[model samples]
Target chain A: MRYAFFPGCSLETTAWDFDRSVRAVCRTLGITLEDIPDWVCCGSTPAHTSNASLAVALPVMTLQKAKHMGCPVMTACASCYSRLRTANHKVCSDPDERQRAERVTGKPYDGSVEVRHVVDVLVNDFGLDNIRARVKRSLSGVRVASYYGCLLTRPPEIVAFDNPEHPSCMDDLFKAAGAEAVEWPYRTECCGAGLSMTEPDAVNRLGHKLVSMARQAGADCIAVACPLCQLNLDLRQADAAKAYGAVLPTPVLYVTQLLGLALGLSVGELGFNALTVSADSVLQRCEMVVSAGRGGRP
Target chain B: MENRLESTGTSFLDEVQRRSGTPISACFQCHKCSTGCPIGPEMDVLSSQIMRLIHLGEEKEVLESQGIWMCASCEACSTRCPMGIDIAGVMDTLRMMAVERKVAPPDARAKHFAHSFLQSVRHHGRVYEMGMLVAYKFRSRDFFTDMDKGPKMLMKKKLAFLPIRSGAASEVKEVFKRVEEEKEQ
Candidate 1:
């Protein structure tokens, strides 16, 4: 299967590991991703939080470029997916805005191009059953908390992908890879997304709550689909502990990283070491690594 | 932290409606938005109270309160609201209005960060994390805040030194120009 990929700005910088693991996992699954030519930033939280028109225009520009690829546009970052989808919705739903945006974008965006998250592509487009067929060394006995920290599913009408209240796509994805997804609340809670650095105190408090909830539920590692979520849970975990007074070595991992490991991809290939909390001890306990002579199935 | 509740010449509700396109009259004070909000406790005015303030045309109070900045825009309130009011979107509208009116200071660095981030994207087509954060420090005048995060993220190779500009610089510029024109209208 071939598709156009729009790795937003975060992927190139802070979430570089997410970008790497996404490519590595797709290579194993035989999914070819073509880079959208002249692709720009998705406008992120800055655009919407400041000006409405810029938010609509920035993503529309990229989505317009993705249309040339004539396939689904996949995004690794949840914030990018939300921005792109919001732009698509605005132009499709309003004729006046569409006419105005057409003048700016130089194309009619009837919202034809499908903007999707990578996890959605894996579970629905690629089929979880098909993905399960490729797992050679499964992550048996490893308990994972599927963390969906807003954007992939919110303001249901705009995103229209998963259940807003309680999402299960990530859970099914982890289970297919042979890891038991522990049921936990606060999966869709806010993680102080754009304020991680600016307002460190509030973010640390929020992160502390999320980590404490996950640890209380007995998750060995936290799996997320969004870059900001992974950063707050993994990188700022120490600050969260210091603020909220719970110290657990709960690792935060990207969903693809966990799935890639189960698919027999090496730790390095999946960017496992990028995580602040170490996954070595947990993976060792689960006996996930195959011998040096044997690799995952091709 | 009280703002002088003054009568405005322009309709405050109309101003919010013009910016966000969310109907303030639809909110029936269900308080569901407040109950579902994760950061409601941290907020000084809470979500439902902000909606009421908007209705009452307490423009200064609505903009000055930490509630709007505290909102993470998780859409939890937007999704759970019985009347289908986009409380989160309204929060965005309030934040932008606050910034436009130059009311945000000290408490809402998130607003300043967004402005700096937009400046970086307008220049480079994507975010240079180190560059954007540095510029935000200068703009917000909080240079020491979150400075410790630098060395660690740099060591992890999370902060790229240089930004890669693609072929869409002119197009992005045109888009920003149009947005500004739209705001004027």
Candidate 2:
């Protein structure tokens, strides 16, 4: 399968590892992902929160670029997927808003391009059976809490991807990769997002709740589908804990990284080293760790 | 807790409904949105209150409130609303109207950051985090907002020193100019 990739803004910097690992995993899975030339920002929370016209206009411009490629545009960032999908929904469904967006961007956007998240690409496109066939090492006995955060499934009419309240796409991927997916209540909860920067205290309180919940639920690690959730739960974990004298030691891994591990991709290839809380202990516990350059099956 | 009620005319509700494309008149103050809102405590005026205020035809106070600026837009309100109100979209429309009408915003830093973010996107066709930071710091005059965060991000290579342009930024700028000329209600 082939797709036009839209890496969005955060993937270029804060979430660079997500970008690399996504590319590496896609290549290994025989999925062709070509980049859209000169794609602009998806406007993220800033645009939609500021102005409706600008929000719709910004994403429509990029989707129009992908439309010419005649392929589905795969997005790794949850925020981008939400914004892009919302733009597509608005332009096609609301005639008057579509007219305003067309007038603003000075181009006709029929909102016909297909926008798919990489999580959807992996679960829906690749299928569990095909992915199970590629597992070189089993992630058995390792319990995982699949953190969907928001955007991946929210305002259901806009995302239309999975069960908004209880999504299982990431859980199914974890299971097929040989790990047990833990059932948790905060799977679809907000991770404080940009509020992490603007309102650190609120973010810490919320993040602490999520981290503490996952740990309490008996999961050794948390698997996230959004980069923001990964960063907040893993990177700024200290900030989350220092809030209420809590201990948050769970390792947060991208869903792709876990699958990449099962596929026997190297530690470096999966970018595990970049995560703040190292994934080494969990990998070792699950017996998925490989000695460098040995093509390990242990 | 009298609201100093204003006249219930003036097309404010219609304008908000038109801009957001949501059924503003359908909101009946179930307060389900307020209960589900995670940031409702942080907001001066809660999510349900904003809808209620608009319904009461109280535009001035609602537009000047900090609730719109503080909202995380997590969609808890939008998702749980009994009337299927796109409550978050109404927040966005209020923010836009607050800007275009030149009203004094309760949160100046957020407004400044929004402009800086758009400026960076307009120039580079993608976000240049460092450039956007500089633009924000210059405008807000608050260089120490995240005093050590920038350098730490730089050490981790999460913040670039130079711009990462798409080489076709002219196309993005064209879109920006056109959006500026948009005269839609």
Off by over 4 Å in 1: A288-298, B1-10
For model 2, residues A11-60, the per-residue Cα lDDT tens digits are 88877778877988899999999998878898888888776777888898
Q: How do the residues B159-180 of candidate 1 rate in per-residue lDDT, one tens digit apiece? A: 8788877578778877777778
Specify the highest-lDDT model's number.
1
Give the lowest summed-lDDT range of ten residues in model 1 chain B. B1-10
TM-score of chain B of each: 0.87, 0.89
- If you assessed candidate 2 against the hidden native complex, which CAPRI class would it receive? medium
Best by TM-score: 1
A218-267: candidate 1 lDDT, tens digit per residue: 88888999999999888888878877897687989998888888887887
Candidate 1 docking classification: medium
